[model samples]
Target: MIETAAREQRSAEPVVRPVRPRKLGKVPFVELADGRLQGVVSSGSDLARVYVSSISAATHGFSCSTNNNRPCGGLSGGSPCKHLRALADEAVLQYGLDRVTRYLRVEAGDDDDLMSRLDGTREAAPAAGVFSRFLRHLAYLELPGSTAPIAEMHWFPAVSAEVR
Candidate 1:
């Protein structure tokens, strides 16, 4: 039976115990009205890597202008933020690693486009203008390896100016 095969598959892998959802904190996910799911993964070490990689690719030569902006400077807190945690959780729950890898590729493409645009326009824009543009661009990025917006979640402020 298909169920037996699925059980066997699950058993063969190292158990990735379902983390308590609350442990993901502010990372958010949505259950659609039709029972489909969509949202950003915002937690876990692997997920953090995905997000950091995406941000780095997107803003290659740019310094973050916002004092509160943490993405470009690296995860500023002791650990990955809730946004990254939620994104990772959703990826695992829905598509697994294969899909997650594909999603990251797509996100990287988007970041490349943004970087191209920024490169084209940076000469004409002021620093603040560029920063604002970056934020606006970020708003439109579908969370890498996800089809949904990085859920609107509050991330804890970086604990110190020293980048981790």
Candidate 2:
């Protein structure tokens, strides 16, 4: 049994770590297409918008209406709520954090190029409202509802025992 275990461990396949269970809002929208790689997490009542900034991949932004005092997530929170960690974890798991940051930077560059290309055809005067144009172009993602609220779930750490 010891020899078999050693052989398996030596195999070329990348080691797979068990994923930790998330204890925050449900994520229904994760957009990586526009290069921002944004996610919207909702808990039926409140919503949190988390995104990789176009300015910097290493930089992360999160906004939640409930966070009127201080940001509840990892970025700004003193305690670092699970919701913040969960969104970041989801992005990192899909694309390593480094790669995601680089990708966002590249995408931001592409956006600039596109804007410059359309400069001639673009409006000479600003829109009715300052951010009206920007808001019109923004994409809104909605989260699905669960039969039972996530807050009610019982969570515990995993454990294993070996007999001698």
Candidate 3:
């Protein structure tokens, strides 16, 4: 009877183990045109755009708002978030700025005026407005959904205990 009771008690006890959060993987490097290793870049002129895109892609997804301020999980509310850093790092590794600039010039097309508008070297123009809207749409596609609503819908941080 005593042995049976002890066994039952031991079986009822819960086991506990340490838990660790998963780590984000490192970004890969791309080769550049200058015989120097760098990350992938569409063009030198597009470097700023690319940097913004990558960072926004990495951190803008599923953000929460508290007190009217948005906080991104991957970035923790930092400007020029990790995604931007990774993109820049990759770009430096893949191509020097010179190559990137040439690429941008080639890609910008006959609309030299549009390029200048984006570069902010000229007065605000109608084309700039259209381009801005297009970029906003792209950003929307990259980061979808409101994290605040999701958080309000769920209860998190489950309780755990250990028995010895």
**Model 3, position 73: C-alpha lDDT score:** 34
Q: Tens-digit lDDT track for model 1 on 54-93? A: 1122222222222233342333532333443344445444
Sorted on lDDT, best first, the list reads 2, 1, 3
| Cα misplacement distance, residue 40 of candidate 2 (Å) | 0.9
Ranking by TM-score: 2, 1, 3
Rate residue 112 of model 1 by lDDT: 35
Top TM-score: which candidate number? 2
Deviation from native of the Cα of residue 19 in model 3, angstroms: 41
Among all windows of ten consecutive residues in candidate 2, which has the lowest summed lDDT?
A: 118-127
Tens-place lDDT per residue, model 2, 46-120, is 444332211112333233222122333343433324443454456555554445546554333322332122112
Give the number of the best model, judged by lDDT. Answer: 2
| lDDT at position 29, candidate 1 | 35
How does residue 85 of candidate 3 score in lDDT? 44
Against the correct fold, how does model 3 do in TM-score?
0.23
Which runs in model 1 stand beyond 4 Å of their true positions? 1-74, 106-164
- The lDDT values for all models are 0.32, 0.36, 0.32
